[model samples]
Target: MTDHLNVVLHPLVQHKLTLMRKKDTSTGVFRQLLREISQLLAYEITVNLPMTSRTIETPMTEMEAPMLAGKKLALISILRAGNGLMDGVLELIPSARVGFVGLYRDEETLQPVQYYFKVPDSLKDRLVIAVDPMLATGNSSVAAIDLLKKAGATNIRFLCLLAAPEGVARMKEAHPDVPIVTAALDERLDEKGYIVPGLGDAGDRLFGTK
Candidate 1:
């Protein structure tokens, strides 16, 4: 893990990611693999969450146990593709507050244009995790984080299944404070701004679209 990036190479994560990258993988299988990999990534990103001790009765006696501190976590999913990752993380942190940011990239300009934005209240008080399946161009990811910071989120982390070197550099330059956790860091982006050796368009693969 670098200062701001954690590339998870866990066997399970790698295995599932390989399955996802296959062009012949069915939408149903791809979606399932994404969910499972997201769960594993979620575990890595939240390893050091603040904790507090709480008195609890185990079976016969009262004992102190470590428990999560602060308000419920905030999860911001960056539109259609992000929904796939969000579902799995939600399974682990079921009490986390959910939010969504919708952005689409302009083919000509290669810029992100926001179409929708909605997030939970008190973002400043909770740990926020932003989920997107791929970080290819990084325009939308950076733009989404910009909106999140404007909304008062201070402690934020970016989680994705695949990331390109270009996207990682873009994110590091744009928001050095936000740490990133991903399953694989691919070689580079293709001319069309898709990660080479990536699992294809995550949104389209998840939804069975062209």
Candidate 2:
């Protein structure tokens, strides 16, 4: 597996991530911070998106300006926690097409079982960015990517708030070509399989649940 993880190690992201790590951070504060960090990371993740020049009338004269090239961009949220990250990215890329992948864990197998999955047409032609908040075991991330590929997404990128080494390795083995953009590359997962020194379940924190 290639050690090609594009972890965003910016100080601001680190500081906010630390604040988010604290158990005392309130829901409102946590949500706000996540959005802020996601926006900053989004800026870095989308740096290389293809652009095309288009003729437009400027304030003074007609001129050609660079705009996003090819089919409309697509944002495929891996449901629940992914939605939290989705909101911030959508604010930055407002016009990008949106899709959802809903998966629930199966108690017996400890595996991600897809409940729902849908995406826009021509995903292969568009630049598709898949969002999920946590890269815990990477089960769902891999599954989501598989579904996207089946739906015709060739050019793909994965965005997340936090990732564990185990998850990174799993993703590397599954899809080395896909670039993963994240705020932090955290320590290993603990006995229960949660990231060590990591913020607790992102879904619970984001939704005010157990």
Candidate 3:
């Protein structure tokens, strides 16, 4: 993926991810960890956001204070696992707008088929961040980004909990302009298109299912 992927190696993030990866971690605990770690990832992803200054008076004097330069951000969740990450990001950026792109992978073909998509208007004026828990084959992530661009989102970033090498490569080839921020990039995708040594199905783990 060249230098497009940002693997957050913060100690706290890695620690929480380790616990989340364990097979015995309860669904409630896993969901909590994801929420917490997602906030940290959000911090990293927004680090270089464009900033400008605004004049403000502090009791005695007026001074220039830094403020976000662009329109309210658009947080697009690639459901249903993306919702887990989205909740945490929204905690930090409460004013950011939210949207959803529903897609399911064809197990046999390993391709993405979009079923639903709804996004905030004026995406071209905002910094659109797309969130999802796992980036496996990258089919769904790429497809989601495609839809976002078609809707007028020129600036976009991808946030994920875990990623496989194949998925990263796929995204790099398809959308080199979009940067990827992830907690950990795992080994590879297994035969079933699941990240090997991953935390298992993220949506199921987040919601607790077989």
lDDT of 1 by residue, 87-136 (tens): 99999999999999999989988899999999999999999999999999
lDDT of 3 by residue, 36-95 (tens): 999999999999999999999999999999999879999999989999999999999999
Angstrom error at residue 176, model 3: 0.7
lDDT of 3: 0.96
For candidate 3, which ten residues in a row score worst on lDDT? 1-10
Q: Scored by CA lDDT, what does every candidate get? A: 0.96, 0.89, 0.96
Would you give me the overall lDDT of model 2? 0.89
Off by over 4 Å in 3: none
CA lDDT for candidate 1: 0.96
- Give per-model TM-scores: 0.99, 0.95, 0.97
Cα shift from native, residue 200, model 3 (Å) = 0.2
Runs of candidate 2 exceeding 4 Å displacement: 1-3
